[model samples]
Target: MTSETTRKKTTEKIVVVGINHAGTSAIRTLLAQDPELEINAYDRNSNISFLGCGIALAVGGTVKNPEDLFYCDQVQLDALGAKVFMEHDVLAIDTQKKTIRVRDLKTGREFQDSYDKLVYAAGSWPLDIPGVPPEKARLKNIMLCKLYQHAQELIKKADEPEISSVAVIGAGYIGIELAEAYRQKGKNVTLIDYETRVIPRYFDTEFTRLLEDDMRRAGITLALGEKVIDFAPSPQKPDHVGQVITDKGHYPADLVITAVGFRPNTDLLSEAEKTGNGALIVDGAMKTSIPDVWAVGDSVAMYHAALDRHQQVALATNAVKSGIAAASSINGIPGVTVESMAGTNAICVFENNLASTGLSEAAARELGLPVASSYIEDADRPEFMNDYGITRIKLVYHEKTFRLLGAQIGSHGEINHTEVIYFLALAIQKKMALPEIAFTDVYFLPHFNKPFNFILTAILKAIGLDYEAAAGKSLERRPSLEGK
Candidate 1:
């Protein structure tokens, strides 16, 4: 037998609690290495892993079936001799007793399951607007964008002709996507945000301006620098029963979806008292302040090496990485250490795929660092190939050292566009110099890319270096917040 099979045969008890992308990936990876590790997961949802990013696309009718978005099924887990409990709500975590108090939602039976090592990957929940109690959620047409069931219900409700207007109360990622989805369905969509601009924390003002322009072109109404103070059902028009009272003005609507970000899922560790900002405080190894108990995903906050503080990065990548990190630590093994949990996320906005890693320009500037940025706008290939796609790449670097700090790319070329951010992330992790990136070898083809590629072109400009004349066109420009 292989060493991996031998390791699995020798391994002992291990229980992973929660069923999201994080928990699923962790269990799958650990099982691959050591299948003898006892695995048990508890989630109130019917499925183990769900692609939350595709929920809006599914609602927009782009995705034919909802099942296509569900990542891991119960049968997959069952094949591994793992007990998959659907609709199993974990009530409490008794670290002292090493047992998790859980209740089967179907049978209403409670039980305590013991574990030698526990992995808490209980993800996150969307933020409920302040002043709107749980009773407000009782409204027939009002809901928050979360869970697959919510997406299905919204899709069905949004399809009604009577539901003409929708007030989405946030300009974050989910809010932006949901707004576009509603607009695609021929509904008048109004997005409200307290921030001055959408995605203020994620992208620079110029990039955000580009995104806003795309949103406006897609027929989305934005009420930025405004907060919804109260909600009242319309008295004059009962069919149009929703009224959102914002600081700027009142918005009339038929339905509302509050996508104002999320709070970590840390309610189970109340007795631990080390919880802050809805997440348990954890160290670099994903161990909580309380001994033996570990937390991962959105439910736990850790120090970001880049930002250097306990921050919550509620992305799927961070969730899965932290879960794997926690599992390895529990198994007395060394795992990958992610200095920064800020996700390297790739998103499709309009026709362009925009990807980002580490900090945004604004975020980096906020730390009082002297930062220089280079903006290179060029095509991904030669003009003769009939595949001309414009790409905008922004590279952030330290003014003194010229060390690569962060990068963001927006483009249409699928391969080059997707890998640029990931490649930049690797460079940032290794502290690679900017001058060395221009020579990195990449595939070349007439239909695929130009000789130097867009990424290499961007880096050469950022590092104040020169490239060969035989490559594609290049327009190197210093990026500033003035025109944007």
Candidate 2:
């Protein structure tokens, strides 16, 4: 007989709140570790694993099938020996008691469910404006673009003949994509944002200027540096939102889609410690402050290797990573925690390709980081190659330590090198310096890249090595930006 000291601890029951990417990842990882583990998953939404990233593709008619957006469903989870409650809402959670109060939307029945461990993956919600009154939310043709239903509504409503002019609030990825999508559908599109530059968090002014020039050339109205006040009623349809009113000016808009931002849906557990944005703070193991409780996805703030602090990065990549971390820790899997959360991202619109990882120069300076940057535009391959294309790169790093902090890649050519950001992201995570990046052994061919690729050239330029090679002299270190 096994003594009490030698007895193995078992996690028989686990409760997962929300079944988006984060919750779905956690559920799959846990079941793979132990098939017999009884898990109960509750989500307020009727669907699961609705990839919001594909919404723009769907809207642009690039994705022919809507079914392709979903990778997992409640049926699959149910068949995997885990009970999935669709349209079921978890009203409250008690970590001390290890129980949750749940309400089934179908039956309107309330009940209590017990769990040995809890994984909170509540995800995030589209940010709403406080200036716009609650009644304004009832305005017709004013929609959001986060959920599957929202995507369907956007695709359907955008095709209407009456939707001749479309205005998208917020010039972030979603807003810009939707604007370009509408333009592709032959509608006059207008993109509005308070920020002076689009995607300011991930891009600097130079990159955004190129993107903005492309958008303007495509006939998309860019109302940057304007504050949205309210929506006005059209004379034809008083109930519909006709045009968006801004502090600077008002533009005619038959339809308005708000893609302002997202806020984490982590307020359900009042006792849990959270960030200023209400995202739950999680440790390296994805465990929250409360015992037996873990938080993942956009609903939680995980430590960023580059930022050296917990931040709410609402990207599917981080969400999936957090979910895997939570489940692996619960399954007693060691050394499985994600070592990098660089917040890497990419976007292609209007034939312009852009990708970023870690931090932008503006974001780093805002956080009081002693950051310096090196930007260069050069041929992706040997200039002698007939099909060579131009690629631009910017490398940001700490001026003192020369540690890689971030990288941005942009190109208007057919052959894009944006994927090179993955290597830079690893460098930031490992705290590699510019000299190390310059020495990386990357394969090069005329069809792909030059012997000294654009990434290598960018790094060399950062540490004054490129000039050293040109002048036939060696330079020891990079010149300080602050000293300039």
**Alpha-carbon TM-score of each model against the true structure:** 0.85, 0.94
Model 1: per-residue Cα lDDT over 328-422, one tens digit each? 77766775555555457776755546778777778789888778887766667776866466667888877887777778877542434667678
| Candidate 1, poorest ten consecutive residues by summed lDDT | 475-484
Best by TM-score: 2
- The Cα error of candidate 2 at residue 470, in Å, is 5.2
For 100-219, candidate 2 gives per-residue lDDT tens digits of 999999999999999999999999999996587667666899999999989889889867998899999999999999999999999999999999989999999868888888889899
In order, candidate lDDTs are: 0.75, 0.87
Sliding window of 10 residues with minimal summed lDDT for model 2: 475-484
Q: After superposition, how far is residue 111 of candidate 2 from its true place, in Å?
A: 0.8
